[model samples]
Structure formats: C-alpha cells, structure tokens
Target: MRHQTYGKLAVLAFALVLVSFVILGFTRAIVGFRTARLLAAPTTLLAASLVCLLFVRGLLAWSGLRPLE
Candidate 1:
C-alpha cells in the first residue's frame, strides 16, 4: 500500500518535472536568456523533486515493497 502510494507520488512528481521543463523551454525561447534563466529555477526544483521521489521509490522497492505489482 505504501509502495503504491509512493509510486503514484513519484509518477506525479515526474509529470510535474516534464510540465515545468516544457514551460521553462517555451519561456526561455519566447523571452530572453535572463528571463529564461529565472524561469529555470522552478524547472530545476521540479527536477530535484522528481529525483527525490524516484530515489524514495527505489528504496522502497529494495526493501521488498513492490509498488508496481
């Protein structure tokens, strides 16, 4: 149960990263380098969050918590 929840949360986090990356890319392209760099903050944050979630999920799986099963 916990593993499943964590898996879902990880997936959500990854989705957020994807969305943020797209937004950052578009903003950077449409705006200038300075503005794009500013927008990168959130995208970077989302990426970090996604990585954390994936790490957590991996730990859980290693502990015998099969979320995908």
Candidate 2:
C-alpha cells in the first residue's frame, strides 16, 4: 500500500514537472524571462521534493523496510 502510494506520488511529481515546463514556455513567450524565472521557483521546488521522495523510497527498499513485494 505504501509503495503504491509512493509510485502514484512519483508519477504526479513527474506530471507536475511537465506541466511546469509548459507553463514556463508559455510565460516566456507571452511575458518575459523575469516572469518565467519567478514561475520556475515552484518547478525547482517540486523537482527537489521529487528527488527527496525517490531517495527516501530507495532507502526504504534497500534497508528492507519497504520490500517490492
């Protein structure tokens, strides 16, 4: 159950990253670099969050705290 939740969260995180890029591209085209840079903050934070989640999941699996089965 926990692993499944993690998997779903990971996918959601990836989707968010993709959406962020689309937003960034649109803003860069319509507004400017400054606005795009400001918008990038959330994307960067989401990327970091995703990395942390993956790292914790890996550690749990490695330590046998959360087995694949």
Candidate 3:
C-alpha cells in the first residue's frame, strides 16, 4: 500500500512538472523571448527540480524506504 501510494504521488508530480514546462515554453515562445539569457533560469530550475525529485524517489525505493501509511 505504501509503495502504491508513493508511485501514484511520483506520477502526479511528474505530470505536474511536465505541464509546467509546456506552459513555460509556450509563454516564452509567444512573448518572443528566444534568447537563452532571457529564458534559461526558470527552465534550468524546473529541470533541476524534476531531476532532484526523481533522484530522491529512486534512492528511497532502492534503499527500501517505504512511504508513510
């Protein structure tokens, strides 16, 4: 049950991140902010956060750390 819950939460979090990235990309494109300097920070932060979350979740699973009931 705990593993199932964590898996669901991880999927939800990933979906949210993907949605956010699409929104950010569309906004930047519409606003004509094509330059890397203008759009790098937020994109980088979002990507980093996603990566960190995945890493943490993977580590937890690998180390046999179950989610809270």
Candidate 4:
C-alpha cells in the first residue's frame, strides 16, 4: 500500500505534463509561427512526451508492475 501513493503521484505528474503539452500546443496554434517560434521546435514537444512516458513507466513500477517480467 505504501507504493500506491507514489504511483498515484507519478500518474498525477504525468497528467500535469500532458496538460502543459496540450496548452503549449494550443498556444502555438493560436499565436502563429511569426512569434513564439521555439514552440515550433519538435524537440520541445518530444521532450514533454518523453517525460510523460517516463512518468508512466515509473508509475507502473510504483504500482507493482515488474516492467521486464
């Protein structure tokens, strides 16, 4: 049961990151490419995706799922 909290926290963090990614994407769409050009970089979005995925994997571990097994 101790790990459940960490698992939940990880999931919550992942959700937050996901929300931020969406918000950034939305802003990029609305603001146009003339300004805020950095948002257009694929790396920014890719990094967010990677972090979220890592959190998801960690969440699984914290929830007691053996990843390699």
Once fitted onto the true fold, the runs of candidate 4 whose alpha carbons sit more than 4 angstroms away are 32-69
lDDT by candidate, in order shown: 0.74, 0.81, 0.64, 0.61
* Of candidates 3 and 1, the better by TM-score: 1
lDDT at position 17, candidate 4: 59
Candidate 4 lDDT score at position 33: 54
Best by TM-score: 2
Kindly report which residue pairs in candidate 2 clash with one another: none
Model 1 / residue 66 / CA error / Å: 13
Model 3 Cα lDDT, one tens digit per residue, 12-64: 66776666567667768667655533555565566567667767877776787
Each candidate's TM vs. the true structure? 0.62, 0.76, 0.47, 0.43
Ten residues in a row with the worst lDDT in model 4?
34-43
- Number of the predicted model whose lDDT against the real structure is largest: 2
TM match of model 4 to true structure: 0.43
Tens digit of per-residue lDDT, candidate 2, span 1-69: 366877888888888888788888888998888899688769868877987978787788889888655
Question: What is the Å distance of residue 20 in model 4 from its true position?
Answer: 0.8
What lDDT is obtained when candidate 1 is compared to the true structure? 0.74
